[model samples]
Target: MRYERADLMTGMVQEGLQALVDGRHGDPFSILGRHQYGDLTVVRVLLPGALSVAVIESETGKVMAELEPIHEAGIFAGLVGSPVPYKLRIEWPDAIQETEDPYSYPPLLGELDLHLISQGTHYELGRTLGAIPMEIDGVDGVRFSVWAPNAQRVSVVGDFNAWDGRRNPMRLRAQAGIWELFIPRLTHGERYKFELLDAHGNLLPQRADPVARSSEASPSTASIIASSKPFRWNDADWLASQAKDRTREGAMSVYEVHLGSWVRIAEEGNRSLDWVELSQRLVPYVKKLGFTHIEMLPIMEHPFGGSWGYQPLGLFAPTGRHGTPEDFAYFIDRCHEEGIGVILDWVPAHFPTDVWGLARFDGTALYEHADPREGFHKDWNTLIYNLGRNEVKGFLIASALEWLEHFHVDALRVDAVASMLYRDYSRNEGEWIPNQYGGRENLESVEFFKHLNSIIHDRCPHAFTVAEESTAWPGVTNSVENGGLGFDFKWNMGWMHDTLHYVSDDPVYRKYEHGSMTFGMIYAYSERFMLPISHDEVVHGKGSLLGKMPGDAWQKLANLRAYYGFMWGHPGKKLLFMGCEIGQETEWNHDGSVVWDLLDRPEHAGIQFLIRDLNQIYAKEPALQFSDLHAEGFQWAVADDAENSVYGMLRTSEDRSSHMLVMSNMTPVPRYGYRVGVPDEGRWEVVLNTDASIYGGTNFGQMDAWAHRSPEHGKPFSVALDLPALSTVFLRWRG
Candidate 1:
């Protein structure tokens, strides 16, 4: 019976040691580190290049035992008296080194963190999942973690380990699918990537940390171990003001900028300015131009710069092209201190499919859908995020919060929202899948948006979200509790399309398309809108906003000036892409900086001055800012004047105590005596005239007009004035 008793078949230990040598061990912590082998304190370590190893007391630095080579791969093991605080003293051919053993410590990830991460509700992943620097058992090192559920094994590999996966295989918390390891003596600024074997034990390309806070610049894709030390903030006043502005009723004139080419150092290989330089130069420029906010094109780290950050991979990291993450934070703090709100263009709709990215993670369709119909974006050649996965949704939510809460960004302009809202977006009928209800609407994405928006509003009340949805999606800016997606604003793409088309036609032909200019008011109040002249309108051979005008150089400047006047005077807040303000004559080049030399020309400089004045007027007038979201704030004074190409819009305050009239004449023929209706009777002074010579126009419009109590164009008060050729005038009325 004693011989039949299976003597604890200890062959599994040999197999585990073999697996450790092969770097295929799934649980490194179980076999390595300080383990009690039935009263014998056994210590095992994998130091690939070490010729000799000694276990030493961590405090006194006394060598306790010499470890013999267990395998040719340089793994060493020895039985000490008992488990005590210790460090590894190793000798290489060229050098001898001493450091704390990585595997000597217990798991640092907590039970609550594991539970929240598994449930896909860990909003603070920036602190949880990435390579975090911490001290474990009085030993200083970095705790690296990643979530790759189907990986047979995962390792933290970097220069320190000679990029060898076998040196630092991690421990998997099976319930959460996260593999973690704490490597002693590792500190900030170390570059690392995760090497994983697929569930089939086939090696895959190393991947950058999905929650990395810092990344190497484009063309190089290593994740950097960043210092988690908090930035010293000086924007408490700005935050307090934002908290008081729950309604966000003030004017919002956003200057859309692409940091890469906004300005470049022509002498320094045409390199873009760093964050410090931008804070010194770009911030003052935008503020001087009277812009209230600056919306940067996605600053997220991406592999290709030409995509202009529209296709991004590192959502949690600001691109290293500009500067370090702290430098970016300083830039934001500077913007707030200068009273300029900062908005980051966020791309949660999709991620580029780089092998080292989140695509095919763990040899599975992890962050994206397995099926092409639901996962691929043919137009962009990118992979759509699988928001249907609760974990992925949580990941993106945590990414957004990283910006809103950690970076103190004022807003997020969610890009390509239309793509997320529809399953068949930019696809043929057979190339798409339907929801459970057999509908084209992406129901999972809808729920994700509602959930994300609700969480964001509940947590960060001082910040808001805007949607770049091209479609007429209902309730885009409505509250989630009212069955809406709960965005604060939506881009007015229809107005941009219709008005750009109207302004590009010859004056005689413009009369035929006059309805294009006035049709926006028909449904303007359906959703809160921001009329965006975005970077999309300026790039990819579309030409500059100025180049789109149909006329001679002088007339083109006048046309653009009139359009800006009309846009600023019209309903909704404003957003103008860079280079448009100075009337850039060429299509935007992502590789080059803005043509600041264009300002040397009188016509171009005129356009710049015109935009500055328009922004000032928009901000100074409460009727233009606060009365934007409701129909009661607007009324048509002249809508059916296609023959004369004249349209009049009367903007009134919510209390009706203040009013302004915007009369736009699309034709070049001067109307010596044109009459337009106004809301009040008295003097209606021309607050702004786009025709003034300072803005490169004929300068032939009346300075002011008298509004009599006579009915004209369905209003009680009528105003008579000489309307300039191709001009928009803002007539402020006071009784």
Candidate 2:
């Protein structure tokens, strides 16, 4: 009986050694670490391609024992006298190295972390799961963790281990399906990836870290270990005053930018400016142009440059194409220093179908859906996230917070929210799924949005959210408590399409489409709106904003200037894409920069000057800035003047302390004496004229007009003035 028991122990030991060598061991810590069987303390280690390994007493600096090559695949084992603090002294073909054994340390995460991770409420998921630099028992190293619940085995493969999976397989913390490993002496800037085997032991492609804070530039997909040092921010005063200044009652003029295409260094290799150069150039340009904020096309890491940051895979990582994470922080700091806000375009809708990314992570539909109809975004050929899973929704929310709180971003303009809200978005009747109650809404995504928005508002009250929702979904900007999506603003897609269509027609036929110009006022106040001329209107076979106008070069400039005057006078916060301000004749190409050369010509320069003046007037005038939302802010003066193609209105301040008269002539023929209604019977001084010679117009408009006490267009006062051909003007009552 004694002989049989000894034989059983030997067999068990050999089986474990073979599994370790094969890289198929499920419990690596159990088999490859110091374990006591009665009296003897056995130590096992894996030093792949090493000639030999010795156990050194850490405290005494003495050689404890030597390990034998139990398996030819570099699995070494021996009795180390007693269980003492020790390090592995490895002699390889290249050199000798000494390091603390990784398996000796305890698990990194505590019970609270496990609970939060399981419930998908971990706001610091980025800090917890990714490669975090830390010290364990006075030994500095990187603690690598990943979520691959379905993976049978996971390993941290990098240069330290000679890129061998068998060198440092991670230990599974089975409770949350998280795998972790502490590689002693690993430091910042080390590149690594997770190698995994599926449940059936089938090898899978290595995955880039989903929570990586920094990554390699495109054409390479490894995650770089970021520095653990805290970045010192110089925007304290800006942050303290931010919440008070950024109210819904204040003006918000966003200048949307695709950083990769904004200003290419043409003299060089046609490369885009880095974060430092962007700060030195873009900030002053926006400040000079009088824009309140700059909204970026998603700066998150993506494999494809052509996606323009819409299909992102690295949610936590800033793209490495520009610079380090610290460089990004510096750019934002510079913006705040200049009193300009930053809004990032965030995409939580879908991700590209890259096999080595989050798609089929762990050899299962882990992050995305399994069914084709439910999971696939056929319109873009992407994969939809499985928000039904708590972890997935939590991951997205965590990513958003990482940007808003950690990166000091002022707001997040969530992209493609309409796609996530509806189950049948861009799908035929049979090619979609329904909710539990047989509705078209994606219920899980709805819940996720409410939760995400509520949490952001609760945690970061200074920051806000915006939605790029094109559908007529009700209460998009309403609070979640009020049965809405809880966004601070919604892009007015309807207004953009209708007005652009109206202006694109020749002045000879603009009267027929005049209704399109006035149609927005009917439903303008349904939600907190932003009149956005975004990147979508300038790409994909669509022409540039300048190209959209139908007329001669001179008339097109006149028409565009007039349109800018009307847009500022309209009742909504504003957002305009980059090249639209300069009147780039060509469509926006992601490969090229905004046509900065156009500013040399008077025609394009005039449009730029018009936009600059419009922004300044919009900021200085309380009537234009403060009254964008309330119903009493705007009143129609001449809504039904389609025959001569003219429109007029009055904008009142929030407290009724100020007022501005805005009038537009859509035709090329000037009206000698166009009578318009006014609220005050006195001298109405012309504040700005889009047709003025400085704006490259026909130089025809009245300098001022006197309002008489006579009812016209239902106003108690009336005024008559010479209106310019294809021009818009702003007037103030000099009472």
What is candidate 1's CA lDDT for residue 16? 80
lDDT of candidate 1 over 17-100, digit per residue (tens): 788778798998887788764555778788888999999998888888898887778878777766779989999989999998
Report the lDDT of model 1 for residue 260: 97
Clash totals, every prediction: 0, 0
Candidate 2 worst ten-residue window by lDDT = 1-10
Clashing pairs in 2: none
Off by over 4 Å in 2: 1-11
Report clash pairs, candidate 1. none
Error of 1 at 164 (Å): 0.7
Q: Candidate 1's error at 544, in angstroms?
A: 1.2
Q: lDDT score, residue 173, model 1?
A: 89
Give Cα-based local distance difference scores for all models. 0.89, 0.88
Reference-based TM-score, model 2: 0.98
TM-scores for the candidates? 0.98, 0.98
lDDT per residue for candidate 2 within 267-362, as digits (tens), equals 899999999999999999999999999999999999999999888889998999899999999999999999899999999999998877999899
Model 1 TM-score is 0.98
